[model samples]
Target: MCGVGGIFFKSAEHGAKTGEIAYRILDGIYRRGPDSTGVALWHDNADGLLYVGVNCEAPGGGGRILEALDQLGTVKQATDGDGYIRAAIAYGGSEEDLVDAIDALDPAITVSSVGRHLEVLKHMGGVANLDAKFDLKSYDGRLAMGLTRYATESRIDFTNGQPLSARAVPGLAVMHNGHITNYHHLRSSYALKGYNFSTQNDSEVIPIMLIDEMSKGATFEDALNITVDKLDGCFTYIAVTDDCFAVVKDAYAAKPTVVAENDEFVALSSDPQSLREGVLSDIEVWEPGAGEVHVWQM
Candidate 1:
């Protein structure tokens, strides 16, 4: 099993670093998944230009990705760890524009995440070790989602980690905690429509499925409704956008999930026990019924 969790600051008054908050929740459930941890944070730089983080095994190997960045616009800023690198892309084009350009650089270059406000970073380590590489504490934003992998569906590299971004739609990230039984059918269908699959993991399709529906002008909720009907699985997944946070549980409850909300924030984790760690202990906790959708709109 994998640990999927996220936290959204509902009130602008709360200026806490959302990535750190997401890390805390994800760390709480670290026992559930210790293979690798990934996080997505939403933040709009003062320039109004979009920032996207592209990651590969090492910063040295990312020279090709860097060259593609030059063609986009300007590389405003960049950073890296042992094997992961992030660049602030200032392209007037859609978020997918940056992603596609990076994908064109090399097959190994994974567009970790792209958004006007969100950046995705993940690596091959646990909650305790991963944070030492990148500074999640400074990742201030409105929404963040993350996952710790148990390596159920794919290899344990950083590229195969959770919080997979949807290539067709930027600013959309998905974290899944269980297997999808009908993933091959769905994957084949999306591939036919020009949606590329970059990972072997079944959960990556969740965000792709959502973004596909979203491209048709479907609301976030409507897209999820279609996802529930189209995919067959026992899973609890969470999705994040610049404007809203959504959590959906499969009818079979194949995976566990718990939610706690207050005026300031909405917190979700794999289980109630993890939700209590460094979170709002005073608030009430409950499980969304199977097939239930609990959404908090910003």
Candidate 2:
């Protein structure tokens, strides 16, 4: 089974602590998906213009990415992380425009995440090798989610990894466990509606379908509820947006999930063991009922 886990702070906390905790949570669920790891985080820079996390394949977070984005707008802040470059670009443009421009400059550059408050980092490796490519402990944000991908229906590659953000809207992120039996049917429908897809993984559609509903003016919760009814599968998904964190299960309640929360933090995992490994021993934990929905605002 694939592993999906998330930790959301009720308020913005110290970046280092937040990052460190994210790592711990991933460690708890490491066994669930040892093939690839993905983490998505949200933080605001207090600017009206959206600040994107540029995860380009530039050698040394170099001038190539800067040159490409320079055509769009100024680079306000940039950093060379474990194995990716993170940058904030100032541009009053759509996310598609920014990503397409970067691809034009360097086809190797993958915009892993784009949003005013979101950053996604992932690579083709396991928990044993994750630290070499990413330092999620250094990532800071009000909320975060990580997934360990155990490839089933899709090929094993970095591009197919989970914690996938929507193509049209990058701020929303989804981490799912279990298979989507009707993935092809749903993907076909989205294709007919002109929604482009990047991977064959069943989990990828969760964010795309969820985004489609939100684009139509549905609140995140309402969109999630609608998605549950539309998708036919025994799956569970954890969603994190700029404003809130949520967990929703399929109607059958086939997948496993546990939640633990106190005044300071809220943690979710595919199993109770993960919750124990990720959070303090004193926190109360319980299982969510079938088709249940739980959400906490950041």
Each candidate: RMSD? 2.0, 2.8
TM-score of 2: 0.87
lDDT by residue (1-298, candidate 1, tens digit) is 8888877787666867776666678788888888988877777567866656666754476666667776787888766655567777667876666777777666667777777776777877776566777777666667777888888778877678878877646677888888898999889999999888777889989998888898899989999878877889788888877777788888876788888888888888886766776474755777888788778887
C-alpha lDDT (0 to 100) for residue 90 of candidate 2 = 82
Q: In terms of TM-score, which candidate is strongest?
A: 1
Model 2: colliding residue pairs: 19-137
Clashes of each: 2, 1
* Candidate 2 residue runs with Cα over 4 Å from true position: 13-16, 47-63, 79-85, 105-110, 127-134
Q: Which portions of model 1 miss their true places by more than 4 Å?
A: 280-282
lDDT of 2 by residue, 65-150 (tens): 76777678888776555445567778888889887666566554556567777767676565435555555666666676788888
User: Global lDDT of each model?
Assistant: 0.77, 0.74
